[model samples]
Target: MLTTRVVVRGLAGLLAAMAVLVPSAPPASADQVRGSQSRVLRTLGVDAAWRVTRGAGVVVAVLDSGVDPRHHDLAGSVVTGPDLTRGANPRGVRPGRLHGTYMASLIAGHGHGPGRADGVIGVAPAARILSVRVILEDDEPGFRHFNSEARFENVVARGIRYAVDKGADVINMSISKDRPTRQERAAIRYAISKGVVLVAAAGNDGAGKADGPYSYPASLPGVISVAAADRALHKASFSNRNSLVLVAAPGVDVFGAGPGDQYWVGRGTSQATALVSGVAALIKAKYPRMTPALVAQALTSSARRRTARGYDPGMGFGVVNAARALAEAARLAGYRHTASGAGVQDPDLPIAAGGADGRPQLAPVQVVARDTGLVTMYGAVALGAAGCSAGCLVVLIVLVRRARRRREHVMIENPQADRRRRAPT
Candidate 1:
């Protein structure tokens, strides 16, 4: 159970300040080529990554305000999963409720103009989005009618579980709370166990308080915590600086799709988190069997180290390098073979070798071939599942079976039900 007083006291001041600081949504526009203005894409080498993979056959779950699935830039990418907020209509677009839509576009938006270069082309343009509504608009009328912190907590927890159960490859949580609860921790652990990659924002309270409490989910174990970087690859002043921050991305003046077929600019760790999530989707598309821990390793290991030393409080490892990370993932996927002995050739193999003396000598050589069979198998499976969209059905069946077993266990533990019924007559 949650008390309204605690939530009001904890978030009222912060939410009020954000309403004034964060830019308001702009009017709908016809110009769709504005995505080139996004500095993050150019700085992070997204174009090079796209040459290798476009995040096809991957699903990223966005947990935030409801996304506008019908947005021009996000058409056919957004999949409405669930609306956990109380009294809020599912998938309904309301004014001041476009945060999730913006985040979704940043992760997987496919531009709608004359060509692919137009509009907001997300870092992972071919990825699909699983929109899970977990936030409610504070400006809505009768906002106090909803339940207290418990409601918010339950919604977030449920959203995480739902995303994992629905076969989300990467889970992007752009929203943040000051602290983590038991339910939230359990939900995150559950997702990690299912091989889901979790990414979250490091909070935006960095003006005078660089030492604020670590943000929830982002600071949680097994979650990739992201900080905000500006166009120059420097940490944003408003991005909270904590040791929990794992990496940084371009979050300043980040452009994305908004509600009512409009586009807007946002600045915060939320945008940075979304960018990282998109990159994670790309990695998953290339290597579907990658574990959550290895995914984090791929991002951090290949990051462009900006600081002189090991780590920085503001920048974490450094700005994410998408091309470098993808290259690393590719290397990780190759097969490793060891030679039996140094400078030894196969006895039965015919080899033409020339030394200083005009005599046949063993030529020093080695050959390594990729396991194309395994690669083809995984590729075929990915293509088949994407063609039919049967990924969710498999997960749904597993979840249903688990639920049934749990209910059966409860009935077995409670024999009092039969005793009560027999005596009730």
Candidate 2:
């Protein structure tokens, strides 16, 4: 019950944040089946990144409305998990899965058809997806209820932990919120500690200018916040300009797969986030043990920096270049590579970044230090509770032995002790 209240209370102003990442309304138009990849591929240089790895052996968790594994491009790649919004709404409310499906296709969609040539090909075409539904579409039934429901208030926080536990190499959180929750921040820290790369949309509230409201998860430390970019390499008019923005990706007129054999062209920071997540997958697929900080380093270091010296609020370091990022990752991993981006094939690399069981591990010293006070506090509480339990057990055992001895003495030496027991009374 306390946990429930925390989750509920933690969502005090979070409802406003959800509207910034995913568009408040469904794609206004351009919803159709495109027979080829969107121009985003060319703009992102994903083909060159493919020479390094097609994101094989990496699992990206998509936390959003829900993904349709049955989509033509996403077939055989998506593994559905629990719906965070289940039963949270009142009776007779159903949600639509347009957003989540679109994001997943951008992350791991493998186009269907002869030679796998047709349909929308994702940035990381060979990666797998763990689809964990954490939100409901705005137009869907119960959308308001889901947002207002206490049980679902901590959906995004829970989804982050769930993805990390499921061995996700990278997490794509195309969703954003204005209100920051303690649970959500802790969850982001947990993922970072576990060496999981997290990417999020920088919000789409930038109306062709700067100084947009900060977006959580994206604004949260250790997360690679992605902003939307246009074909001309300019920040999208709708992309949020904030300190959290790490890198930009193609977000204008982005083509992606829908819930079925359908496709849609949408423009938002959400699409850009998915593309960045795909790039992270490629890095992890090549260097399975690279820490989240280094993975982020690889991205920021190799980006087409917007300025000469430092980062800009609009696009941060600049647009993300996949092939260059791969090269940077290879350099950080101390592995040999060819110009084609394929080189050292370390079969012995550990699958999980830290431990085999996917436990949270300590990050490198040079990595930016994050607040682990929550983890320490929880640990201290658990330790204190365990100590109390042990002390109680010791006292109980001593009392029990004393009682047994008294009973034995009453039977053997003081047979009249029982009769005299009530004397005082």
Candidate 3:
């Protein structure tokens, strides 16, 4: 479904334009887990519980620079993409080259092979990748730091649309703009309509003035915002907190595949967002029929809720729990099935939490007759169907029994002696 090539222009110069006053972030805390303990891997039971299940048949579109498709860990998982920063050239596309590539590796890179050569393994190692290069061509150094303006909002929107067209089940926007543009919001809405789950960083400016509503996509409605957590599972000093943030993941000291088969570590919401995106991929893979609403609920509900009641502005649902989320998804879906199959119909079937996107058709279940009478009617229909099938089966058994009785009688009457006399005559 991926249709058009997005053209990135002046905006490529924007990513590095941030003011120099932004202080250098402190080194990641020692308690922080290295890249290996990313929330995505922990939540999804990567090595301990989860085994590959067809790799989810889900594609995650990475709206960043071109991915090193040949990376040891990502060789087969990558899909060809456009260079939004500059037009495709013979030399190849390079936006914020290392940044984008590293992000991709965290989500789906195959990683180093035996003996430390494989590099860091990504959270969703089996998921497919779609890279969109949007960094400016003239701002290479700015790409390294916050010295230029990154036209990421527009490019991100367009890239999102392309990702939806390409059948991506999840979209990871690791890049963040100083503010959310109308275009960016609209693009996000469009992607939602297409059934794509979007994840974004809460921002690295948590300790600085970069706090407050200033966080763009992370604070935006419908986005699965993420904050950074250390190895001890505590929030990162630089990671922003608010009710809008959905969860936290291992961000500090997170390592990923870099250019030239190397690995690098960094501290930022970018890593957290990638890890969450990977978790989403795992959920989609486990339950192909699940809707985004159900997936989100499962993720939030399974999380170790923050100390505050309800959804605290700091952590939307809590830290994600891979095993618990999958278990919850299966449990909820099962309950829905039971309600649907009961003698009565469940009127709320149309509005169940798991069927929001409307991609898969819901099987009619028995509607319970309650204050919500409409549900009762559906339940009646379900009972009727079950009853009808049972009645037909009984009728079939009766007919078979009658035929057997008749055959037995004829065999008894025609004894062996009578058969022999008729044959001789």
Against the true structure, what is every candidate's RMSD? 30.8, 22.3, 16.1
**Per-residue C-alpha lDDT of model 1 across residues 169-257, encoded as one tens digit per residue:** 99998866776666677688778777899998887778787575587778899899999898788888878889989999988777777
TM-score of 3: 0.64
* Candidate 1 lDDT: 0.76
lDDT string for model 2 (47-130, tens) is 788988999999999988789888778999999988878886566765567788888988898876667776668888899999
Model 1 segments more than 4 A misplaced? 1-38, 88-96, 145-149, 334-425
By TM-score, the best candidate is 2
Q: State in Å the error of residue 400, model 1.
A: 82
TM-score of each: 0.71, 0.71, 0.64
Poorly placed runs, candidate 3 (over 4 Å): 1-44, 52-54, 87-93, 112-117, 136-153, 208-211, 308-310, 334-425
Between prediction 1 and prediction 3, the one with superior lDDT is 1
Q: Tell me the lDDT of model 2 at 310.
A: 69
Off by over 4 Å in 2: 1-38, 90-94, 335-425
User: With candidate 3 superimposed using the best TM-score fit, by how many Å does residue 289's alpha carbon deviate from the native?
Assistant: 3.0
